[model samples]
Target: MHRVGLTGGIAAGKSTVAARLRRLGAAVIDHDVLAREVVAPGSSGLEAVAEAFGQEVVTVLGELDRAALGAQVFADPMARERLNAIVHPLVTEAAREREAAAVADGSTVVVHDIPLLVETGQAGHFDELVVVDAPPELRVQRLVASRGLTETQAWDRLAAQADDEARIAVADVVLDGSGAVSELEDQVDALWAVWADRHPAGSAR
Candidate 1:
């Protein structure tokens, strides 16, 4: 399948772009969704995380306390590295399985919606990279409005990521999501046209 890597900073509308691609017949694998699945209550992923971050990070329900862990990693570089060491490998493995399954199912284009594609140096995993981009100020505004994050928290999340220029530099396709949904959909459809022509039988690597 034509595996296209989709990514953007927090609240940059990567999910919006992914949904548009899905509606246009692109098979989409959301990394955030897969990440959560990997760490479901009794999963080995959770156990590994607990071992890395300690039992205090695990909730009474046997799930990871995401907020607490986010606080830990976002504030401490070493802690984030430690957490990534435990989770990144599992995410990568799960992503590979999902991608392989999608290809086997005859998907024409598989879009991997990963928020940390650039930060994690996973840009080379796909046939092409598409970045959903917007100015940092707009991203923070969207985060506050949509996710109920305070202004400070929104900026903090954005600040933790690679800058907009760095991300755009690596994008083979850049979708500007600072406008209406229809505008974004048009861009998605445009990309789909290219992908369809390139990988008609879903045989792209």
Candidate 2:
């Protein structure tokens, strides 16, 4: 299977593009979904996380209290790193398992929708790295509106990411997300064609 890593800055419409790829018949493994799954209620991941961050990070119902955990980690670089150290490997492992299953099922192309693909320096693992591109201001605006983050909070999160130039520099495919949704759709449709041409019948989309 052709492993494509799809990534973008926060609020850059990565999920929208990923969903479109799925609708077009590509097998997509959403890293965010796998991130949640790895830490679900009684999983070993949750146990490790609670051990690392204390039980306060877990809800009464035993699921991770994401908001509380975010609050603790986002403001502190060390805390964020600590959390990621425990979480990222588990998420990555689960994602690999999912990808292997898709490949076994005869998928021709498998896309991993990952937000921190560049930040983690894992882009080298993929056959293609597709980045959803948008201006920083647009990213901030989208984050504020969609995620309810304050301007300062949005900037802080953006500050934590590699700059747009850095991200675009490494992209094998750049999907411009600053324009209308229809524009993004065009990019994805064109990308689907390219993938089909490159992989022939082995790929799903």
lDDT of 2: 0.88
- Residue-by-residue lDDT tens digits, candidate 1, 22-133: 8777788988888898888999999998888888889998888999789888867788878777777898899889888987877768888998889899988789999998
Model 2: what TM-score?
0.94
lDDT of 2 by residue, 1-205 (tens): 7889999988887888998998888889999898899899999999998998899999999999998887787778888788888889999999989988887887778999998888778878899999998888999998899889999999988877777888888999998999898889989989988888887883353
Least accurate 10 contiguous residues by lDDT in model 1: 196-205
Worst window of 10 by summed lDDT in candidate 2: 196-205
Q: How many backbone clashes are present in model 1?
A: 0
Q: What is the lDDT for 16 in model 1?
A: 82
Candidate 1's error at 112, in angstroms? 1.0
The positional error of residue 2 in candidate 2, measured at the CA in angstroms, is 1.2
Question: Candidate 1 has what TM-score?
Answer: 0.93
Task: For candidate 1, give the lDDT.
Answer: 0.84
